[model samples]
Target: MKQRFLITILVIAMFSGCKKFLNVDPLDSLSGNNFWKTRQDAETYTREVYRLFREGVAIRTGMILVGDLRCAPVAYGAYPPRGDFNLLSSNSIRTLVNTPRIQGDINTYWQVHGAWDVISDWTPIYKVVQAANVLYEKAPDVAEADQSMSAELIRKYQAEAVFMRCLSYFFMIRLFGDVPYYTNAYNDVPLPRTKDVEVAKACIAELEAHRNDLPWTYEDPANRAVRAMRGSAIALEMDLNMWLAGIDEANKKMYYEETDRLGDELTASNAYKLLPMENIAQVFAGRSEEGLFEVPQNVNYGDVLGNIRRTFTGAVLHYPYIQLNQNSTKSELTYTDGYLKKLYPEEANDLRKKYWFDNNIYNEDGTMQCFKFFNLALGENNTTASLSNYFIIFRYAGALLLQAEALANLEEGSQKAEALLNQVRTRAGADLYSAGTDKNLPDAIFYERSKELMGEGHYYYDLVRSRKIYNPDYCYRPISYGNFVQGAWLWPISEKALVNNPHMTLNNYWR
Candidate 1:
């Protein structure tokens, strides 16, 4: 039999129905005098919301299809199995290796199912929002009751919750054009969708409100790399403002100004810097100084998370009979004709391309597999524990590049932007661009961002946001420009997300 649990079986309600969204209501048996009586209660709820970052690899809630995998750089096709012809010929084995890979394949097999749902499933993401709401709302009561709860501790908890909600909404607005904004858990009735622009502004405002409460690092040193910081909030603010500037021309100057301000704030923090080129791989491994924010991954708690680098973006498994002369590893993605040649020219002498990618790593066809995500944590005791690589959500380089983009777009900021761009390029051992090098500063920034932020899940969003998705001259594969212009880039809402919600409406294109 299952344990009944001490206070409530569920920390945050699993939402059995609209009425059961939270386990304890103000008037319920688990509420008021019973709960919010200790700092531990608030901390527990905050921890539950943290699980969202941990769930990055779950097929239902992961970033794979939504952000990176569906982007232009990837060519989804065949991946050879880890055996001789005699072993691979069996029906069961062939089905095992080919079916799952083929189903998700966007090009060759072309049998993508509920494709949008892979990323657009709003249920779990909303649950995170719900948990944050519950914790944030209870912060005041928890402070009043627990004498041991310092003002700073209470503020940190509340700020963490706010960060969670802000990030969740940012993800929602970026992926879906409009989404219902929920602030409290008690409102179970369906809410109407809010404009993405309005939601973005609200997210920025929230981060600004709570940014001061978070420290550069958590008290637990293990959490230093994993936890959110003031830098994280500042980075998100810059990104959202710039996203607004890119998509909406009417407010371009205003958004760009804010983007510039936020970027400047992050740079002035003096808390982060780009990693040394020789140690670029260390950037993705947990808590490097280069990271603004990352999700900690280790052997015990990291297994459930599917690492895109080692699992999805790796090369096909190689064996004696395959004749491909490859190693036995599985990678769901690879580069196509135009990706490498366009951004990273042969003579560019880019250090990152050589450091982070290889032509001969289990791929003998002269194709490439990303080396950026190879796990340094698993150097010796390694198995299939690919999740050991700390998921690098935000880092110093992204912060620097985003700021450079904002500067490039402004009228007088072009020269400063060029210097900023060259800072990153020079560090990477690439040639610096002279003045008037690019057609315009913005395009130059986009090109720079594409090269600098590859495989970090920022490229697709950059293209769509910059309106570059409409330009056929961009990357060659993945979603077509024609379909993207038709609003196909925004995902269709899941049918289940619409159940029993009268006010809910699907994206018009999908409907």
Candidate 2:
């Protein structure tokens, strides 16, 4: 048996202390034989895939800006240094995309702050896919080169690599409708956009085959949810199924049934559980059993580095959590009264209402703050503080709601749906479901998600997938079915995508 060399030198160099190394770009090095030689090399390359995904989403709070901000429950307040809150809240993609940034122009806050990077740039995401592709193609060679690398370990690394690649494509389709998909490690052949449904189907089959290769959980507590696990793979499958069900509506029943079954399997594993309401702070702190997958952040070690203030938490929180001025009492945004009421009615006994809000959820005033992502940091003079919550992508409770949703849409599965829905509701100390003549189980489940996952970046996508975006009864900013069919919901693809690839086209609805 030979030694397993460490990749920590490259990892540390990538993050900091080496500007020249980053400038040269190291992802391409993975394809060379000089790099991928041992089990540690395979492990390190997989970690790089995760790092690329985190960077892609961390840009301008990229995931939240696209996933939660658009048509979210937020309203702009009369505060300095605000993004296009109205544009985001109203789902105005064309105008927002076209907004120009001129010096000294407060109007260009969104552009000046890199809204284009969030809405258009797929480069970082593609980098994730590219790295994953390289890992998947090259990991097997490690077993041949290093006697210590076992076939089982090599398969696990390949499974993790494919998982990240599929996850990246899933995000791309949600944001841009269709995207260029590829799998060969270093191939540079120009490609056209594949139908997102085809992309989803291909990814689902790939993950289904490798799902058992990953473990249900890691023995190391720190690695539990942050690393790829069987739960994460299944959760991603559920999400892909739901997204397909939304687009490929003719066969939605099949998708929903698959989602329902996946949800049951995830629950039956008993590998995760929802934390008590009092421990809600712990839940957001990351690495908890509830966190199925999250982009880890630790302000102390500077893991998030200089991007702390630009996170999703920064947009909705104010003084105490973050101080913009001597009297920074107001958040830059607030939830709308109508939307707040829709989720948590005046008399609703929801614990989230108490734990997640400051002042009032219905308060039209900008002083209202969402405490769900608030993890305070006190800076010099207490003037430079910011929240340190992990960028949560998937959690156990969210999986439960997804299951509830799938079952509600299936034939005669409403009873099972209520049980799953109530599990989350019961954990929150909110009222458990009891059937009523006036009750709508599906809507209730959706509303529960709206309240529970509020600001965690799931709301806007939920609206789009459920076609609640077409219903004024459900969506605060409803889009007509015709407009939706025209791709009005998708962000415009970056013009950069068309520079070298003749087959690339933009989302013309926004144009």
Best by TM-score: 2
Q: Give the Cα lDDT of each candidate.
A: 0.63, 0.76
Clashes of 2: 0
Q: State the local distance difference test value for candidate 2.
A: 0.76
Q: Residue 449 deviation, candidate 2, in Å?
A: 0.9
lDDT of 1 at 9: 43
How many pairs in model 1 have backbone atoms within 3 A of each other, for residues 3 or more apart or on separate chains, i.e. clashes? 3
- TM-score, one value per model: 0.83, 0.91
**Tens digit per residue, CA lDDT, model 2, 102-206:** 777776754655455455867667767776877888898887778888888888888898889898998889988878777776554567898999999999999
Worst 10 residues of 1 by lDDT: 83-92
Q: How well does candidate 2 score on lDDT at residue 35?
A: 78
Runs in model 2 lying further than 4 Å from the true structure = 1-32, 59-61, 81-83, 301-305, 376-386
Q: What would the per-residue lDDT of candidate 1 be over residues 229-277, giving only the tens digit for each residue?
A: 8888888888888888866779888887887788777778787788778
Error of 1 at 158 (Å): 1.2
The superposed Cα distance between candidate 2 and the true structure at residue 388, in angstroms, equals: 2.0
Q: For model 2, which pairs clash?
A: none
